[model samples]
Target: MSTGIPNVSPNLNLETKDLKTAPGVSLNENQSTVLRSILDLFAGKPSLPKLALWRDDATFTDPITVAQGRDRYAAQWYGLQQAFSEIERLHHEVTDAGNPILMDLKTRYVIKGINKEQTINSVVAVHLDSEGKVQKVEDKWDGKLPEGSIQNVSSLLDFARPMWWINYYIAWAFWIWSFAWETKKKMTADITAQAFRHLNAVTVPKLVSVPKNEEEDAKKGN
Candidate 1:
């Protein structure tokens, strides 16, 4: 019988990582095998044989990317190796014990060619089809909604870096990100408010009228 999913490329990395669970957590026999296999992909060690574990149309989505099919999901994971030099699994824990397993992972990342590091927490929700094949994997970074339309492969690297409001970057990243965003937002709002105020300023005539010599003045100003 053919699995709907394509056979994983033999060239794909089958390396595995040690699954480090959070304190006070004990996994059942099934959860141990399943979670270990899945978490290894994010630990900078992807498993090629595990591709058969997912269904053909299985989706993997985080905040910035939406991918359909097991192949695309594999792309997101495999891209991790290219995007990052090091991924150290700090700890991970299963938050939900239901059909769609919710596992929260905290890991430290070092971008390739840069020694600067960032610690990120991602919550991976694994949904299983009726036959126990993977149906969908929703990565909610700190429990945020899977909301975004960027389908670029490059944006897949964002998964390895800092993103969204689960804040606390390597100090500088957080400071700059916060300051820049607030400044830009305030500046835009100020500009808009000033524009409206200028339009209704009392220094002008109370009545709104069609421009008379504006065209001639515009040409002269230019």
Candidate 2:
């Protein structure tokens, strides 16, 4: 039965011959094989054999992740298969003159259960060691890497949330207690003043003076 969906892996070739490379520089046989594997990975075809091209300690960096070890790096490529139903390699230009081989990739991605397709352009840089094993890879989408310390500041602020919350609770408790104390003090003073005025108006008490000896004794006791 034709499902009306196209198969993804038809031709993943690196020997395109017309690719723009550095002047007087051509990719070797091993590099071509590795580049083909990379294309396969980008086409959402992740295999154990293709992942074997990377060293054990190889690192990979992309916009969302900075992964260490070949196995860790391969996980992202594997996840790509689960995300998109099909991936079509639209265009690629390779440069192999330097330590870091670069690929400018344009791809069409078809997400599962979605009617629309997305076109994405990316730059992949792979650094190969003497044994032709990948040492590091950096993938930048739309050829842009995130720059600035704002992200670092954001992480710090997130970590400091607990501390901020504790301080806020302490200050709030003090503010409420202080208001309670103030209200109590004002109520007591006002009530005492009103009671004294009402009692004085009701009764005319005899004026009595304390003896000088008793007053001196009270002052000495105080």
**Which is the leading candidate under lDDT?**
2
For candidate 1, write residues 99-202 as lDDT tens digits. 78888888887665545566767888888776666788877766764232322433333454345324433322422232233323342444433332222121
Query: What would the TM-score be for candidate 1 when compared with the true structure?
Result: 0.55
Question: Mind giving the per-residue lDDT tens digits that candidate 2 earns over 125-164?
Answer: 9898877777988877678544432222224435765774
Alpha-carbon RMSD of each model: 19.6, 33.2
Candidates' TM-scores? 0.55, 0.55
Worst 10 residues of 2 by lDDT: 201-210
Off by over 4 Å in 1: 1-28, 146-222
lDDT of each: 0.53, 0.55
Clashing pairs in 2: none
Model 2: residue 156 alpha-carbon error in angstroms: 13
